[model samples]
Target chain A: MKTLTVDLGDRSYPIHIGSGLLGQSALWTPHIRGRQVMIVTNETVAPLYLAKVREALTAYQVDEVILPDGEQYKNLDTLNLIFDALLSRTHNRTTTLVALGGGVVGDMCGFAAACYQRGVDFIQVPTTLLSQVDSSVGGKTGVNHALGKNMIGAFYQPNVVLIDTDTLQTLPDRELSAGMAEVIKYGLIADAGFYQWVSDNISGLMRGEADLLATAIERSCACKADVVGQDETETGIRAILNFGHTFGHAIEAHQGYGVWLHGEAVGTGMLMAADYGYRTGKITRAELNGLRVMLEQAGLPIVAPADMGCEDFLSRMRIDKKVMDGRIRLVLLEKIGEAFVTTDIDTNALNQTLCAGAQLGY
Target chain B: MKTLTVDLGDRSYPIHIGSGLLGQSALWTPHIRGRQVMIVTNETVAPLYLAKVREALTAYQVDEVILPDGEQYKNLDTLNLIFDALLSRTHNRTTTLVALGGGVVGDMCGFAAACYQRGVDFIQVPTTLLSQVDSSVGGKTGVNHALGKNMIGAFYQPNVVLIDTDTLQTLPDRELSAGMAEVIKYGLIADAGFYQWVSDNISGLMRGEADLLATAIERSCACKADVVGQDETETGIRAILNFGHTFGHAIEAHQGYGVWLHGEAVGTGMLMAADYGYRTGKITRAELNGLRVMLEQAGLPIVAPADMGCEDFLSRMRIDKKVMDGRIRLVLLEKIGEAFVTTDIDTNALNQTLCAGAQLGY
Candidate 1:
C-alpha cells in the first residue's frame, strides 16, 4: 500500500491507496479510540461487502446501519437513522464511525459522524473508483436537501481513509466510467501530463489494469490533497478544484440527484466548461477538442441535455455555493491543465457557449 | 456599550453587551457583508422586539423566520423550516442569519447557518438572560434530538453577539430564574468571589436590578470566554463548563425536551454534582451547602426529580457526548471557585448523593 499524508496538522490523516487495503488491522485499529465501532453503508453495498468489513472489525464491538441506496436517501432522515442507531447502542463521542461505500455513503457517514455528538472520528473505506479518487479524500461531508444537492454538510476531515481498489471489481461499467470523470478532473485542473496520460491509458484503465488504476487514484488524490492543504475551507485555491462543478452541480440538481452519476455530470460539465473557455478565447479549440475526445473515449457524455435551457442552467448555477454575492463565480480554464476562478466572464459569451454545447450531437 | 472580544484570531468576534445595543448601527452594519439578511426569532419575542431589529437593518434587505416558542421546537424539523425560507428567498452563502431570541432560537439558527451551504455568518441577538449570560457568548450551536438534548450540533462561533438589555424587560420570571442557574454555575466552577457576590445579591438579581444583572452577565461571560479561548473544541478546560450538564442533559432528555427549562434542570444538576463532589472528598460539605442555599434563593431547583431512579439517570448520562471509552466522564467542583473533570467517582457514592439531594425539600 502507498500512503499519502493530507498535511492538516493535528487534523491530518493518512490516505492508504492500493489493492486490498480494507481489512488491514494495522491501518484501522490504531485509529479506533473506543471499544465500539459503527459501520455505515447502504443496501446495495451492504449485501455485497458488509460481511467482509464486519469480519475485519471483529476485534471491536461492531454495529451496522445499512441504509437504502441512492442520492435520494442522502438527506436528514437518513442521517437521523445513523443517529438513532448510535444513540440506541449508547455509542458515545469516542465511538468511531466507518464509512463503507462510495461518495453517497462517504458523504452521509461523514455528515453523520459530524453531527453525532457535535463531531467524531470517521474512517473512509471508499469502494468505488469515484470515491477512492475524489470524495473520500476531501473533508467535505454533507447530505443533500430537496432544493439542492449537498445543501447541508460540514468540512470535517476523517481520521483515516482506506482505499481498496479490490472492490472496484464489483462496480458496474457505468459507475466505473462515472468515476473516471473525476479522475479526469484532476488532470484538467493542474496536471496536463496526467491528462495526456489518461488520454493514452483510457482503454487500459477501462480494462481494470491494476497498475494504471493505482496510478490514476494516487495522482488524483495527490492533486486533491495539495489543493485541500492550501485551502481546507474552500476559500481560495480550493475553488479551482471545482473547475467543472458549477455547471455539473446544476445539471445534477436540475436532473435530480442519482439520475446521472456525479462523475458523469462533472464529465459533461467539464466539457461545457472547456467549450466555454474556448469561446472566451482563454483556451485553444484544439485543447477543448482534446478534452471532448478523451471524455468520449471514456464513454462519458460531452454535451448538455437538449431539454436543459441556458436560462434554467444559469439560474441553477447561480445558487451554487461557489457563487459569491449575486455573481456566479466559476473556475474556468486558461489552457489545458491550468484553471482559474473568475466572475468576470460575459453572460452573453457563457450563454452562447451553453446553447452551442446543448445543440452539439452526441 | 462594553465590548469583550472572544479572540479566536480569524474567527474572533466581539460580544456587545449593554442596554439597547441592538439599535446601534455601528455595532452591526459592518458585519453585514451582503444586502440580504435573515433574522430568526420565536413567536414570543417577534411581536415584542423583531420590528426594532428589522428597523435597525432598514438600509439592507431583511427577512424573518418566526418559529414557535420553547425548547421542544429546537429540532431538525424547525431547522428545515429556516432552510426552506432561506432557499425560497434564494439566500446564498453571503446571506447572514441573525438569531433574534433565546437559546433555542440562537442554537437552531446558528446550527442552520452552520449547515446551510456548509456555513454562513451568524449573529446572536439574545433576548433572554439564559441566552445572553451563557449560550450566546459561546460558539456551541446545535439542535436537540428526541433521543438526547443537543445530540446533533456543531462548534460554530458567531460573527457578533449583540445583547440588548432592553429586550430582557419582557422576559418572564421563570425564564430569568432559569438563566440564573448558568450564571451561578460560572461562580461555582471558576470564581469563588463571584459565588459570594451572587449569594449576597440573589434577591436583587431576581428582582431585575440593572447594575447587578449587568455585573453578573459580564462576569459569567468573561469566565466562559476564558475557558472557551483555551479550549474551543471542549478538549479539556471547556468541559468544566458542562459541570452539571451531563446530569442536566439526561434530565432534559428523559423528561422530554421543554418539560423543564434547560437552566432549571442544570440548576438542580449543579447541586447534585456539589453533593457528589462532597461525597467523593473533592469538595467540602460547606461548599455543597452554599450551592444549595444559592440555588434555593434564586428560585431554582436544587435536586433531581423524585420520580427518577439512579439506574435511569445513569443510563441516560452514559450516552452523553462527554463519555469516552464506555466510562462516564463528569465535571465536578473542587470548591466554589474551581472545577475539574474526572471519571473516578464511584457509582454507589453518586447514588447516595442523588438520594440525598432528591430528599431535600424544593
Candidate 2:
C-alpha cells in the first residue's frame, strides 16, 4: 500500500491506497480507541462490503447504521439516525465512527462524528474510487442544506482513511467515471503533469488496473494534502481546489439532489467553467478542447441541461458556499492544470458561454 | 452598563449587562461587521422587542426570522427557516445573526449561525433571565432531537452577548421562577457566598430588584466563564457545571421537550443531587436543607415527579452525555459551593435516593 499524508499538522491523517488494505487490520485497529464502534454506511454499500468491515472490527463492539444511499439522504434527518444509534447504544465521546462507503457515507459519518459528543475519532473506509481518491482524504465534514451544498459542516479531520482500491471492483462504471472527475480535478487545479498522467492512463484505470489506480489515488491525495495543509479552511489557495464545484454545485442544486451523481455534476460544471475561462481569454480554445476531450474520454458530461435557463443557473450558482458577499466567484481554469477564482468576468460573456453550453444538450 | 469579558483570550467576547442596553445602538453597531444582518427571535419576543432591535440595526440592512416560541420549537425544522431566509435573500458569511429571545432563541440561532456558511458571527440579545445568566453567555449551540434534549449540537460561541434587564418586566412569573433555578444553581455548585446571597435576597430578586438581579447575573456569568475557560470542551472541570444536568436532562427528555421548563427539571434534579450528596456523606444535612430552602423560596421544585419510576429514570440518566465508556459519571455536591463528578458511587444508593425522592411527593 502506498500512503499519502494530508499534512494538516494536528488534524492531519494518512490515506492508504492499495489492492487489499482493508484486509490489513493493522492499518485501522490502532486507531480504534473504544470498545464500541459505529460504522456508518449506505444501502448501496452495506450489503456489498459491511460484512468485511464488521469482520475486521470483531475485536471491538461494533454497531452499523445503514442509510439509503444518495445525496438526498445527506441532511439533518439522516444525521439523526447515526446519533440515535450511538445514544441508544450508550456510545460516548470515546466511541469511534467508521465511515464505510463513498463520499455520502464519509461526509455524513464524518459530520456525525464531528457533532457526536462535540467530536470523536472517525476512520474512513471508502468503498468507491471517487471517495478513495478525493473526499476521503479531506477532513471537510458536513451535510448539504436545502439552499446550498456543504453549507453545514466543519473542517474535521479523521484519524485515518483506509482506502482499499479493491473495493472499486464493485463500483458501477458510471460511479467509477464520476469519481474520476475529482481525480482529474486534482491535476487540473495543481498538477499539470498528473493531469496528463490521468489522460495517459484513463483506459488502464477503466480496466481496474490496480497499479495505475494506486498511483492516481496517491497523487490526488498528495495534491489535496498539500493544499489543505496550507489552507485548511478554504480561505484562499484551497478554494482553487474547487475548480469546477461552484458551477457543479449549482447543477446539482438545480437538477435537485440525487438526480445526477455529485461527480457527474462536477464534471459538467468543470466543462462549463473551462468554456467560461476560454470566453474570458483566460484559456485558449485548444486548452478548452483538451479539457473537453479528456472529460469526454473519462465519460463525463460537458454541457448544462437544456431545460435549465442560464438565469436560473446563475441564481442557483449565486448561493454556492464559495460565492462570498452575494457575488458569484467561480474557480476558472487559466489553462489545463491551472485554475483561479474570480468574480470579475463580464456578464455578457458568461451568459454567452452558458447559452452555448445549454444548446449542446447537457 | 456593566461589561464582563469571558476571558477566552483571542476568542473572548464582552457580556454587556444592564437595563436598556438593547436600545443602545452604539454598543452593537460597532460589532456589525458588514451591511447585512439577520435578527432571529420568537413570536413572543418579536412582538415585544424586534422593533427595537431593528431600529438599532437601522444603519445597516436587516432581515428578521420570527420563530415560534418555546423549547419545542428549538429543532431542525425551525433552524431551517433561518437558513431559508438567508439563502433566499442570498445572505453571506459576513451576515451576522442576532439572537433576540431567551435560551431557545439563542441556542437555535447560535446553532443556525454555526452551520450557516460553516459559521458566522452571532450576537446574543438575551431577553429572559435564564439566557442572560446562562445560555447566552456560553457558546453551547444546538437543537433538541426527538429522542433526546440537546442530543444534537456544537459548542459554537457568540461574538457578543447583550443582556437587557429591561425586557424582564414583560416576562411571566413562571418564566422568571424558571430562570431563577439556574441563578440559584450557580451558587449551589461553585459559590457558597453567592448561594447565601441568593438565599438572603430571593424576595428582592423575585420582586424585580435590579441591583440584586444584576449581581446574580454577573456572578453566574463569572462562574461559568471560569469553568468554561478552564475546560471549554467539558473534559473535566466543565462537568461540574452540569451538577444537576444528568438527571435534569433525563427528566426533560422523559417528560418530552417543552413539557417542563429546562430550569424546572434542573431545579428538581438539583434537589435529588443534594439528597444523594447528603446520603452518600459528601454533603451534610444542613447543606442539603439550605439548598431546599433556597429552592423553595425561589419557587422551584425540589423533588422528582411522583409518576417517574427509578428504573426508567436510571435508564434515561445513563444515556446522558456525561456517560463515558458505558459508565455514568455524575456530578455530585460535596458542599453547597463545591461539586465533584464521580463514577464510583453505588448504584443501589442512587436508586434508593431516587425512589425515596419520588415517594416524597415533591
Candidate 3:
C-alpha cells in the first residue's frame, strides 16, 4: 500500500492506496477502536464489497446500512437511514463506522459519523476513483440539498482512508471515465508534470493499468493532502481545490443530481472554467483548447445543457456555498496547473460563458 | 452585565449574562458576520421574544423558522425546517443563525447552524435559565433521534451566547424550577460552595429574585466553563458534566420525549446516581439524602418513572453515548460536590435503583 498522510495535527490519518485492501483485515482492524462496527455502503456496492468488509470485521459487532446508490440519494432523508440503523441497533458513541463505497457513501457515512452523538470514529474505505483522489482524503462530509451540492456538510476528518484499486475492476467504463475527471482535476489544479503524464497515459488509466492507477491515486492524494493540510475548511487556499466544483455542483443540481455524475459535471465545469479564463485573458486560447480536447477525449460533456440558460446558471450558482457575502466567487484557471479564486467576475462575462453551455448544488 | 468566556482557542466565544442584552442591538450585532441572518425559534418563543430579536437585527436581511414547541420537536424532522428556510431563501455560508428560545431552540438552531453548508456563523440568544446557565455556554449542538436524546448533534460553538435574563421574567414557575435542576447540578458535581448557596436560596430563585438568579447563572457558568475548557468533546473531564445525563436521556427517550423536561430528567437521574453510589458504598446515605432533599425542594423529581420497568431503563441506558467498549460507563457522585465516571457499575445496584422508582435514550 502507498501511504499518504493528511497532516491535521491530532485529527490527521493515513490514506492507503493498493490492490486487495478489503481482503487485508490488518489494515482495517487497528483503526476500529470499538467492537461495535457499522458499515455504511450503497445498494450497488453491497453485493460486490460489503461481504468482504463484513468478513474482515468478523470478530466485531457489525451492523450494515445499505442506502440507495447515486448522487440523488445523497440527501438528509437518505442520511437518516444510517442514523436509524445505528440508533435501532443501540450503537454507542464508541462504535466505529466504516464507509465502504464511493464518494456518496463516504460523504454520507462520514457525515453520519460526525453528527452521531455529536461525533464518532469513522474510517473511509473508498471504492471509486473520485473518492480515492479527492473526497475521501479531505474531512468534508455532507449531504446534498435541492439548492446546492455538498452544501449540508462538515469539515470532519476520517480515521483512515483505505483505497483498494482492485475494486476498480468492477467499475463500468463510463464510471471509470467519470472518476478520471477528478484525476484530471488534481493535475489541472496543481501538478503540471502529472497533467503531462496523464495526457500520455490516459489510455493506460482507462484500461485499468495497475501501476499507472496506483501512481495517479498517490500523486492526486498527495496534492489534495497538501492543500487540505494547509486549509481544512476552505477559508482561502483550500478554495482552489474547488476549481471546477462551483460549476460542477450547479450542473449536477440543475440537471437533477443523478443525471450527471459528479466527475462528469466537474470534468465539463473544468473546461468551462478554462473557457472563461481564456475569455478574460487569464489563459491563452491554445490552453483552453487543450483542456477542452483533453476533457472530450476523456468522454466528458464540455457544453452547456441544451435547456439551461444564463439565468438558470446564475440562480443555481447563487445558491452555492462558495457565494461569500452575496458575491459568487469562482475558481478560475490562469494556466493548466494553476487556479485562483476571484469575486471580481463580471456578469456580462459570466453570461457569455453560460450562454456557451456550461461552466457550473446540494 | 457580566461576561464569561469559554476559552477554546479559535473556537472560543463569549457568554453574556444580563438584562436588556436583547434590546441592545450592539450586543447581538457584532457576532453576526453577514448581512443575512436566520432566527430559529419555536412557536412559543416566537410569540414572546422573536419580535424583540427582530428589532435588534433590523439592520440586516432576516428570516425566521418557527418550529413546534417542546422537547419532542427537537429532532431531525423538525431540524429540516431550518435547512428548508435557509435553502428556500438561498442563505449562503456567511449567513448567521440566531437561536432564540430555551435549550431546545438553542440546541436545534445551533445544530442547524453547525450542518448548514457544513457550518455557518451562529449566535445563541438563550431565553431560559437552563439554557443560559448550561446549554448556551457549551458549544455542544444537535437534535435527537427516537433512540436517544441528543443522539444526532455536533460539538459546534456559537459566535456569541446572548443570555438575556430579562426573558426569564416571563418564564413560567415550572420552567423556572426545571431550569434550577441544571443550576443545582453544577454545584453538585464540582462546587460545594455553590451547592450550599443553592440550598440556602432555593426559595429566592423560585421567587425570581434577579440578583440571586444572576449569581446562580454566573456561578453555574463558571463551573461549567472550567470543566468544558479542559475537555471540549467529553473525552475526559467533560463526561463529569453529564453526571445525570445517562439516566436523564433515557428518561426523556423512554417517556417519548418532552414528557420530562431535560433538567427535570437530569434531576431524577442525579438522585438515581446518588442512590447507586450509596448502594455501592461510594457515597454516604446521608449525602444521598441531602442531594435528594435539595432536588425535591427545588421542585424536581427524585425517582424513576412509575410505568417504566427495570428492562426499559436497562435498554434505554444501554443506548447512551457513554457506553464504551460495550460497558455502560456512568458519571457517579463520589460525594456531594464531587463526581467521577465509572464502567464498574453493578447491574444489581442499577436494577435496584430503577425498581426503587429512581436512579438513572431513544
Choose the strongest candidate by lDDT: 1
List model 3 lDDT by residue over B101-194, tens digit each: 9999999998989999888999998888899888987788888877777889999999988788889899987788789999988888998888
How well does each candidate superpose onto the true structure, as a TM-score? 0.97, 0.97, 0.96
What ranking of all candidate models by lDDT puts the best one first? 1, 3, 2
DockQ of 1: 0.76
Poorest stretch of ten by lDDT in candidate 1 chain B: B353-362
Candidate 1 residue-wise lDDT, A27-60, digit = tens: 7898898788999999889988888888778989
* Residue A265 miss distance in model 1 (angstroms): 1.0
Candidate 3 root-mean-square deviation in Å = 2.7
- Candidate 1: segments with Cα more than 4 A from true spot: B281-287
Candidate 2 structure quality by residue, lDDT tens digits, B1-362: 88888877788899888988877889997688967899999889988998988887798779999898889888878888988888787788788999999999999899888778778888999998899888897688888877677767788888888988889899888888889999888898899999888998999998888888888888998898888888787778888888788888888888888988999888888888878887778777777777777777888877777678888788887778788777889898887788889998777768877787543222
CAPRI-style docking class of model 2 based on DockQ:
medium
Give candidate 2 misplaced runs (Cα > 4 Å).
A358-362, B358-362
Model 1, position B267: C-alpha lDDT score? 89
lDDT of 2 by residue, A1-362 (tens): 77778787677777777777776678878898878899999888888888888777788889989898899989988988998898787787788999999999999899888777667889989998888877887788889888888888776789998888889888898998899999999888788899889989998887778788888888888888888889887778888988878778888988889998999988988888878777778777787787788888888887777777888788887777777766888887777778887878789878876778643312
